[model samples]
Target: MFTGIVEELGSVVAVEDRGLDARVRVRGPLVTSDAHLGDSIAVDGVCLTVAELPGDGTFAADVMPESLRRTALGALRAGVPVNLERALAVGGRYGGHVVQGHVDGVGTILRRTPGERWDEVEIGLPATLARYVAEKGAIAVSGVSLTVTHVSDDAFGVSLIPTTLAHTTLGGLVVGDAVNLEVDVLAKYAERLLGAVAR
Candidate 1:
């Protein structure tokens, strides 16, 4: 589990394709400082187990074919900045909402409207995931937890403050950039429970 709190902005060092899976090396000094082999880390909101600690402030993780197909990790290449976060420790402060690092779908950046201190970014929400999103509800875009400012049948908007704009990879995203989306897990649970009750 993660809190959607970004620990550091890391960059991809290398992505070695191994047919079905790609071994990705990411350089995150802070997250790799106390990291260990097999430790879980959230890279741009995708939970990946550390396969190797390369001892150069970088960790290697295998991006499976499923992960690549579901998230934007497949598009990662050298020099790509990624939001990095260590898994939440026991009794750790919950800075953001519950984030499983399990992306439900991939969304495309539809448009961006710059404001004085923030920018409103509209993402093309997938139809299957649209029902799980609500205005003012929490959503994780590429591992950065954000509150939904606006919602429609096919899209949603999130505001990036100055801090977020300067910190996360969202600031660099363009109109066609793909982003991983994880809706509020609690909402999914509620829907499941209500469905059981109705039946």
Candidate 2:
């Protein structure tokens, strides 16, 4: 589990395809400082196990085909930046929100409206995941925890401040760019519980 708080902005150093899976080597000195083999790292909101820790500020992990199909990691190329976060330690502060580091689906940036101090980014929401999103709710986009500013039937908007724009890869997002989306896990659990009670 993670808190959706980005520890570092890492760069993809290399991607080696191995038929059904790919080995991704990411350069994130901060996150890899005390990393060990088998540790979990959140890459662009996808929880990936550390396959090898070289102790050289670089870590390699395997990305299965299923993960690629569900998230934007499959289309990643060398030099691309990604949000990196270490797994939450026991009794650690939940700075952002409860993030499983599991990407539910992918969304696309539809438009961006710049404000004096922040920017409002509107993204298209997948129909299947729409029910999980709500205004003023927590949503993880490309591993960054953001609050929903508005929600329509098929899309939602998030306002990004300067700090977010400078620290994460979201600031570089353009129109039509694909992003991984993870809705609040609590909301999903509450919905399930309510459904069970109703039944």
Runs in model 1 deviating more than 4 A are none
Candidate 1: which pairs clash?
none
What TM-scores do the predictions have? 0.97, 0.97
How well does candidate 1 match the true structure, expressed as C-alpha RMSD? 0.9
Q: Please give the TM-score that candidate 2 achieves against the real structure.
A: 0.97
Model 1's lDDT to the true fold?
0.94
Q: Which lDDT tens digits does candidate 2 get at residues 49-86?
A: 99988888899999999898899999888999999999
What's the residue-level lDDT of 162 in candidate 1? 92
Poorest 10 consecutive residues by lDDT, candidate 1: 63-72
RMSD to truth, every model = 0.9, 1.0
Report the poorest 10 consecutive residues by lDDT, candidate 2. Answer: 92-101
Question: Which residue pairs in model 2 clash with each other?
Answer: none
How well is each residue in 1-199 modelled by candidate 1, as lDDT tens digits? 9988888999999999999889999999999999999899999999999999978999999998999999989899999999999999999999999999999989999999999999999999899999999999999999999999989999999999998999999989999999999999999999999999999
